[model samples]
Every structure is written in C-alpha cells, then in structure tokens.
Target: MPDNQNPNYEIKTIVEIFKQENLTIPEYQRPYKWTVKNTNQLIDDILLHQEKSKYRLGTMVVHNNNGELEIVDGQQRFITILLIAKVLSDSNFLDKDISYFLTHLKFSNTISHKNIARNYQAVISRASDIVNEKFAKFFSERCEMVQIILKSESEAFQFFDSQNARGKDLEPHDLLKAFHLREMNDSDSSEKIAVVSQWENIKSEDLAELFALYLYPIRQWSKRQSARYFSKSDIDIFKGINLKKSPAYPYAQILRMLESFTQHYKNSPDRLFDNQEVNFPFQLSQTMIDGRHFFDMVSYYQNSKNKLFNRLKENEQTNRIISTLDNQEYKYRTGDKYVRRLFDSAVFCYWDKFGLIEIEKAVKVIFLWAYQIRLTQQSVFIESIDNHARKDLMLFNKIYEATHPKEITQLLVNFKIESKAKNSESVINLAKEFQGIKNEK
Candidate 1:
C-alpha cells in the first residue's frame, strides 16, 4: 500500500477521467436515485454553461484499489454523463471509434441503471437537438471535475461524508452529523462506524423535518420565544459536547443526571419503568455525542396519546381534555392552528422541567390561557396564537426555576386575570365560565 496520508488530487475533464482509469461504483453505495427532474436540471445547467472556457461540474471522491478506481461519491453525476455519451453514440453523433469505446464503459447492475437509462431516453427525446457531436465534445472535453484519489476506501468515504455535509446541497441536520463526526476523530473505528450507520438509518429528509417541525420549536419555546426555522448556526447548541473549553458539557452532564435519577429511584417502592415513557428516551444516552436524545423526545411527543394535555401517566383528566382537543372533528371546526400552538407550548414547558410529574396542572392552566387568548383576540391569525404561546413559554421559564407546579399555575392565572380585566364583556364572560369549570373541578 502507498503512503495514503497525502493522497493525489487533480482537475480532470470527463474524457480524461474515463481514459486514465477504470471507474466502478462500490456495492455499498446508494443506487442512482436521481430523478428525471435532476437529470433535466443537470442538462440545463451544462447547456447554459457550455460557452464558458471550462465548466466545472463538481468533486468526485475515488479510491484506487489495486489500480482500479472505485467511485466513492459523485456516481450519480458520472453515470448521468455516461448516459449522455451513450445517447450521443446511439444518435451517431460521435466518431465511430470514440462512440464504440464509450459503449464499453460498464455500470453497476442496480435498479438505478434501468432508471438512469429511462431518464436518458426521456432527456434525449426532449432535447434531441442538444445531443449532437458538438454538445458531446463539449461535455467530454470542456466540462471538468475535481478528481480526489484517496489512499483507502475509508478515507474516500470520510472525505465524501465531510464534503457533502459542508457542501451547499446538505440539509441542516446533515451538517450537524458532519460536524459531530469530525469531532469523533479520536474515537475507535467501530464506534465511528456505528454512529454513522445509526445516523444514516434515519433518512435525511425525515431528520430535517423532525428538526423543523418539532425540535426547533420546542427549544425556542423553552426559552419563551416564538419558534423560527432551524438554521446552520443553531447546530452549535447540539454541539460543544466534545469541546473541552465549554463549562457545561452536555454529554457528561446528561450522564450524571441519569445516574442521579437511577440512584433516586433505586430505594423507592413506587418506582416503575415504562418503555414508551422513560426507557426509550434514555436509550440514546448510551452513545457519546447523542443527538439521538433530541430525536427520541420528538418521537415520544409524536407517538404519545393526548400529547398536549397528558404529560404525567396518572393524569387521566388532562389526557381526556387533550384527546378532545386533538379530535379531528373538534379541530376541523376550531382550526388546528390554535390547538397545535397550545400543544407545542405545553410540550416545551414540560420538556424544560425534564419530567411530566405534576405537569398536567401546568399544561391544563396553560391550555386554558391559550384558549382564552384565541377567544378574546380579534383577527386571530396563526401568528397571534404563536405569539401568545411564546409569551406563556417565557413566563413558564421564569417560574420553572422555583421548583413548584403551583408557581406555574399562579403565574398563568395572574396573566389571565389581568387580561380578563381589560378585555370586552364577552371575553370577561368567557373567562368567568372557564374559571367556574376550574373551580368546580
């Protein structure tokens, strides 16, 4: 084996890469899942940039295993280019010998090959005039790619993963994965492989959506603010685990907290464990740099019954109330936006305290406060509900430090009482009625 510590790299045209080495897709690689839309866009990009002195496609990561170059990344683009060459050859656009040699290039026997072939035909049919000798020459000779030849397959994959995360095309969570993976350089190879495998098991689109819809909102709400879209910078909050300079290391702190909880419960007669409620959420903590905890929390909320109202397992009444609110029939008439906002706020508050014990009362009071705001406010847009939820969340955070559920209820009650005094007669009446139900209970 050569000294792969400093691998060779070069800028090569499509024709040069093809002529200089034999390229093959490794079996572990994902099948060419690029759609017709993707191929069409690539074609359009190439055509638009064809007039430039040199059009750079992108970087390709490859490993030389006994002189055979295995493509570790950029297979999709490479295969697409090959299909273009084949299309031109079939059209008799290239010199006979050049066309014949192009035909000999092999592709992996995957479903993607068939799909790519279909897409090629569709592309050629749509833009037959573009698939000429001149365009073929431009694609082969003028278009350039950065060919990165790594020392080993692992290095090639590491390069591919790191570059993909930093690249413009990645989702925010993908960037997080890349950042954490970079930090784990000192970890054993098996540990790193396990992390990557587990991370990949959850699809990128699903992970991104999880952050956007739930985790981001909950984190913001915990600070008593309206939720915004998750961006690149916010990834730092989930980071800092491996950094030594940080005063509060999340990984160590979380492990200590779990240890304390276990010790506290060991002597208790009332102790019981529920997989859905507790065990599953803690399972992710077993791993270092566990972003899995955040994901697990989101999953718990998504799967729980009466998610908004029922925080504690014993709170049947709160569960019933939330179930009623979540009913499609009720939501259809009342609009889901108000209910969703209230649910999110309640969840955030519960999560901040790190347990559902005595959470039902807090959630009940918070829900009523949110309901009153919706009923009293004019022109109740989604934004208005979100603002109210954020305000409530802020108040919750302030009193959360006091370590008592009554403080939360009292704060919400005080806010409601103040708002009720300044509002219209109808609003006052509604508040009185809601109070009557609470008092009676």
Candidate 2:
C-alpha cells in the first residue's frame, strides 16, 4: 500500500482486472438497475469495438478502503461486465480468470439479484451468435478502463463532482438518486423498490428538464434570485433532510411529523370509503423530505407540470387562455415562446402555493403581465423575461410571499398597446382582451 509501490491509478484490460483481486460492491450500493436492453446495448458496443485495437469503456472510481477495493461509481457497467463474464464462462468461451471472477464475486441487493438473472438471460439471447470465442476474447482484452484508487469514500464523490464540472456523462439526477439511496441505509427492500420503480419509469432527460425548466427556476425565483441554469452545484437546493439521519432540528421535526401523519392517513381504513387520496403539502421552495418522499415529490411535480403544457392540441382539461395565447395570429413571434414559459411558471408557482382557487383569474393576471412585454417590445429576449419573472413584475415573489391566493388574484395589471409593434392588428386585439380582464371583479 506504499506510494512508492503503486501508482494512483492503472489502465487495465477487463481480462487483466479479473485476474486481480475482485472489486467490492459495498453493502450501501444501490440495486443493479441496467435493463435487458442496456445489456443488449453493451453486447453491441463490445462487438462494434472488436475491429479496433482497444476501446476505452470509461472511467471507474474505486476507494482503497485499507486493502479492499470498493466500487464507488460505474456499478451499472461493473455488474453488466460480471453478467457478461458469467455468460462467457458458462460456455467455456472465456479464460480461467473470468471463470474465477464468476465463482468469487457476489453482490446481494434483492433487486440486483433479480436483475442479474434477467440480464444473464438477456446476454445469452442477444449474444448467442455474436459472442463467439473471437468476440469474447476481444471484449476481454481490447475493451479497456482506468481504475482510480482513492484513499477515502468521499474522494470518490469528489472525483465525480469534478467530472460533472467538465461535463462528462455523469447525470445530476442519477448522482442525487444514488446519494439519497445511501441515506436510506435502514430502508427495507420494498421501500427501496417503491421509490426506485417510479424513478426508473421516467426518462432521465425528462427528469432533467423538469428540474431545469419548472422546479429549479421556481425555487430560485421564489427566493428572489436569478436561476438561469440548474447545474450539479445547484442540486443542494433539492437535497433535503434524511429523517432518520438528519439532526432533530425544528424544521426536520416538522417535516418528519408531516411525513408520519401523511403515511398514517393514506394507510388508514377510514380513508378507504371515499376512495380519496392525500398529497404531501409541496411548496415550490420547501425543504425536501429526502429518500422516498423525495422521489414521490419529483414524480408529483413532474406530472403536474405536464398537465396542459405538453399537448399538441387543446382538450377540456386544457386551460383555454393557454390556447388563446397560442392562437396563430401572434404565436409565431419568436419572443412569444419565452413569454409563454414565463406566464406558465408564475401561474404554477401561485397554484403550488395557493391551489386552483381563482386559478382562472390568476392565469389571466399572469398572462397580461407576461404578454405585455411581447406587445411593447419589438423583440423580447430571455434575460428580459428573467427580469420580468424575478423582479419586473415581482410575480414570483408575490406568490412566494402571499399566505392566500387573494393577494395574487386581486392585483390589477394595467397595460397599453405599442401601435408601432409588429402585427399591430393582432397586438390591438390582444391588448383589448386585457380590458375585459381589468373589468372582472
């Protein structure tokens, strides 16, 4: 273990790595989640790389816990590699080291155990003709990686922090999911499954945009800050108290008490007659509930944001003024798109804090505030929209500060048409609509 004897890292073939002492999947590691399709993709990637002299699979971070090497990242691919080895070793197509790896390696999360079996079958089904002795040898030797051996577990996360900064493939949601999973050290398998299943069902890209477009901006603007981007550094705003592990501070205690009450209400037989549901009180800027509740909150907001915005055409459920805003007369203006998002975000902030009470009025107020910029400016930019949302209208702040919906709905928005603006006739008609809104009680 002396510095003079070993380099900080090493580049090795998958075959060579198998010959070394096995890497440990610490008990804290989350379940193996790579799907059968993912396993098939790995097989295809290996076959594609067979023609090359060597292909770098990617970097892996391993903590040197005294002498034991524990996997810190890349566990998805790590487990996939083991499943591949198990397949190759089964047919006697691979060498002794791979066979030894199969016999010696063990990781026992229940979800992982189930996935390992499913993916093992998937590898055989996908690779039967493709993974012959030549492909197996190529995968073992020509596929390569660099294993980073840091002295402590925190170093592993630090390494990922730097990697994300450099814009590597480490996804922010994935990193946060794994971090919160580690916090759920005492969670039973079913509880973990309940949380993981919902998350795995949503596409990662959708998750990213949900945070960026809706969740992240609302939190920052509610606090009266500019939130143009939601990067890895900004994720602490989303990560919240772990009830069991976080200190019993007053805020944590309130969240925990609410968590307990909500669970009890949902499970109680008295609530069954109405077939009703209870939603956790979610505010745009409240402290998150950490593990299971964190996952549930994300799922809730993700669904809520999609309600009227994602459709190509309107329905009864769709907010009609949204359709009005999109009417062809003025929708083609390039800046109108930014105005639409600004309007929706403000309304969503109010709706989150105060519910659908006078939401129709709230929408119109937000709409008049939003599109007023479009009517006056020859061209609108995102910075201008950011200004309007954060400070110009103080729209988000009003909602953030209000204890009741009346404070927002009862406000008057006054505006005038700029006749010189492009699309004068459409702008005049749109300006006229604000008159009716002002006349409403």
The regions of model 1 sitting more than 4 angstroms off are: 1-10, 19-33, 44-54, 58-76, 82-135, 146-170, 184-209, 223-227, 243-339, 348-362, 379-433, 437-441
Model 2, stretches more than 4 Å misplaced? 1-13, 16-57, 62-71, 79-91, 97-144, 148-158, 267-276, 308-318, 328-333, 419-428, 436-441
Expressed as tens digits, the lDDT of each residue in 1-441 for candidate 2 is: 456634278898888777767577665565787899988888888887788999888777888877878787777897898788777877787784555556565655567788989998888886665568888878788888888878765566566556665675656777777667656657885676677777766778999878877888888888778877777778788787778777779867778778888889999998868788888887777887777778888889888877635531343323466666667855676687777778778877877887667776777677778777887788888787888777776888888888888888888878765654565454456456666633224
Task: Estimate, for each residue in 73-148, the C-alpha lDDT of model 1 and write its tens digit.
Answer: 7888888776776677667764423443345544444556678778877678755656776787888888999988
* Each candidate's clash count: 1, 0
Question: What is the alpha-carbon lDDT of model 1 when measured against the actual structure?
Answer: 0.60
What shift in Å separates residue 170 of candidate 1 from its native position after superposition?
Answer: 4.4
lDDT of each: 0.60, 0.75
RMSD of each: 8.4, 5.6
In terms of lDDT, which candidate is strongest? Answer: 2
Residue-level lDDT for 229 in candidate 1: 56
